[model samples]
Target: MTKIPTALLLTCDAQLVEIDLPFGHDCASSAERRAVLRAALRCDRFDVVALTRQWDMWIDDEGLYNHPVNPAATALAQRFGFTHQPYHGPVLLTGGPDAQGNTLPLLRHQVIGLFLTLQDL
Candidate 1:
């Protein structure tokens, strides 16, 4: 079975504010994923998390400067060996996949929570 991709937005306090993209999204297309991400950025939140079989990214404004990775995101990514890519104004947290070709949901949630916590600081 193909795993569905999902996106999540979290408040600055680790609360789940929104599910930007729910399961069953057309994650197979990078264009579709980018479109969803662009739409999610229009919201008032500073943190967004994308979870898919292709890639997983933790988007946050904190990593816009000299740091290639957001501190909190780095720590979390280190735990899972995820690669940190820099985005225009947010950090792109990318990582390896599991057996199902999906980035683990637990890791996605944990990364979002961590990003939110760091934003509060």
Candidate 2:
């Protein structure tokens, strides 16, 4: 299965997860999705990668900082032990959309300016 070398922590919600850098597609079971997260973490170029649910309205309106499942997202952070702080202004959230207009259900934090921990990265 070629699982990722990095450690895996279960988020509070138990649905999502956060992986540390030096990350690879092996972190995720799905190749495509894993690639996306790996790329985002590696780039460290973007400020943040907002992940929305497929049917989230924000996809069309483009006005969601975090998704309803953000609690779950937070859980993911805690699970991975990724050190996190309050987000500053002018954050960008982007993702796919669904029938109701919801965006994809996942977001990745790039942490451009500051660094992060493996547990919280």
Candidate 3:
């Protein structure tokens, strides 16, 4: 079967994870969640394209540095190893199939951003 990369929505609570990570469950504590986050980010089993909101508010594409990035988000990105932002922002998160029909990395970092997006959503 063709695998569609799953996006791990990073959040501080439980919203709707069954839609993506069926094998996962609600975390009991912040420490537990962080542990899971670290493992997911560094898992060698597959690539994880991290995602998160860098800025508190939307900004122009060129204005990435013009505004202050969320310190928490920045720390999370750095903690996960996202050398730079990869997904489009200002309200745009697009995706498509891989050439090999292989699923993309379950978004662990953007999954980081993703976790937030799902939280906000």
Backbone-clash count (model 2)? 23
Could you give candidate 1's per-residue lDDT for residues 1-121 as a string of tens digits? 5332244443232334334342233556545545555554442234544444434655644435423423444443444454554243333333435665543333455555545644664
- The positional error of residue 68 in candidate 1, measured at the CA in angstroms, is 9.6
lDDT at residue 49 of model 3 (Cα atoms): 37
lDDT of 2 at 59: 16
Model 2 poorest 10 in a row by lDDT: 54-63
TM-score of each: 0.35, 0.21, 0.24
**Considering every candidate listed, which one attains the maximal TM-score?**
1
After TM-score superposition, what is the CA distance of residue 31 in candidate 3 from its true location, in Å? 40
User: If candidate 2 were superposed on the true structure by all CA atoms, what would the RMSD be?
Assistant: 14.1
lDDT for each candidate structure:
0.43, 0.30, 0.34
lDDT per residue (tens digit) for residues 1-121 in model 2: 5333122222223322333423223444445544444353232223332332311111112213332333433433344343363222222223334464332332333221112332344
Off by over 4 Å in 1: 1-5, 10-16, 22-32, 41-55, 58-69, 82-121
- Residue 41 in model 1: lDDT: 42
lDDT of 3 by residue, 1-121 (tens): 5444343332222222322322223445434533443343322122223233231211124424333333333444445565466322122121222454322334434345555654453
